[model samples]
Target chain A: AQSVTQPDIHITVSEGASLELRCNYSYGATPYLFWYVQSPGQGLQLLLKYFSGDTLVQGIKGFEAEFKRSQSSFNLRKPSVHWSDAAEYFCGGDNQGGKLIFGQGTELSVKP
Target chain B: DVKVTQSSRYLVKRTGEKVFLECVQDMDHENMFWYRQDPGLGLRLIYFSYDVKMKEKGDIPEGYSVSREKKERFSLILESASTNQTSMYLCASSYPDSYQPQHFGDGTRLSIL
Candidate 1:
């Protein structure tokens, strides 16, 4: 079965500090990876996705993710953190036709 | 901007009552999806439609049914509402034959009494 793993359940980073959220997946073929962010009481917003080519993909809100096939990892990164960026981050793998297998999600808390 | 709209932002239904959650997308997307969001569980796919009148079950499809009479609209129906079914229901749409990102609505927070 295809599955996504976000190792961290919760991560806290100080404002102005760099942030990195780890994600790994297990799939048989080349995978389509995505990162989504959900604010409190709101629907998820797409942060970025990696389908093919360009191992490093940029996304909205100054977020970028690097797809490392050898490592089976797609980690989201940002140069600086802001309090507004505090939200739940989810990593998912697409199974065609818009079907997504999502990780348990990592709750990010941006501290002052 | 691609807009996906849900019929309601919040809803309350009694147990054993029938419930309907409607979603519409305006981007002429060929694919539409329904998912439930819960704390710690992230998002779980319930059902999806690739075309008009064509539906497919996702990871979790138990106790739920879907209808897609039109290309831009997808409706999720709960035969019998239960407390466990109370969740944030999200609707999304995406284009076919492309890696385009799925656009989402604000989501409907449903509560079962």
Candidate 2:
């Protein structure tokens, strides 16, 4: 079965610190990848997506993710964290065309 | 910009009552979907409609029915609401072509009493 796994259930980082959220996917072949963030009482917003090309993709709000084929991972990263960056992040994609399978999600906390 | 809109942000209903959730897309997307979002389960697909009157069962479709009378509107219906059904419901739409990023609505936080 195809599935997305977020290794870290919760991660806390001080404001301005570098951040990384780990994600691993299970599939028979190369899969699609995406990163999304959900704020409190809001819907999931697309941050970045990886389809076929370059392993690294940039997304909105200064977020980026790299797809590592060897490790079956697509980890999200940011150089510096901001207070507004605190939100639940989900990793998904690589399903039947547009069908997306999302991970359990990692809750990010940015402390000042 | 692609815009998907859900009818309710929060809904409260008694157990055994029928429930309706409406979703509309302004981008004329050919595909629309309903998903249930829970604390640890993430987003589970409920139902999807590719076109008007055409629907498919997603990962979790039991106790739920969908309607797509028009090309841009999709509706999710719960046969009977239950306390266990309380969840955040999300609506999304995308182009029929491959790899289209789905646009999501703000979501509806449903509560069953």
lDDT of 2 by residue, A1-112 (tens): 8889998889999999999999999988877788889999998899998888889999999999999999999999999999999999999875686788889999999999
lDDT of each: 0.92, 0.91
Model 1 spans with C-alpha error above 4 angstroms: none
Query: For every candidate, how close is chain A to the native chain A in TM-score?
Result: 0.97, 0.97
RMSD of each: 1.1, 0.9
List TM-score per model, in order: 0.97, 0.98
Please provide, for model 2 over B1-113, each residue's C-alpha lDDT reduced to its tens digit, 9 standing for 90 to 100: 88899999999999999999999999988889999999888899999888899999999998999999999899999999989999999999988754777789999999999
Off by over 4 Å in 2: none
Candidate topping TM-score: 2
- Model 1: share of true interface contacts reproduced: 0.53
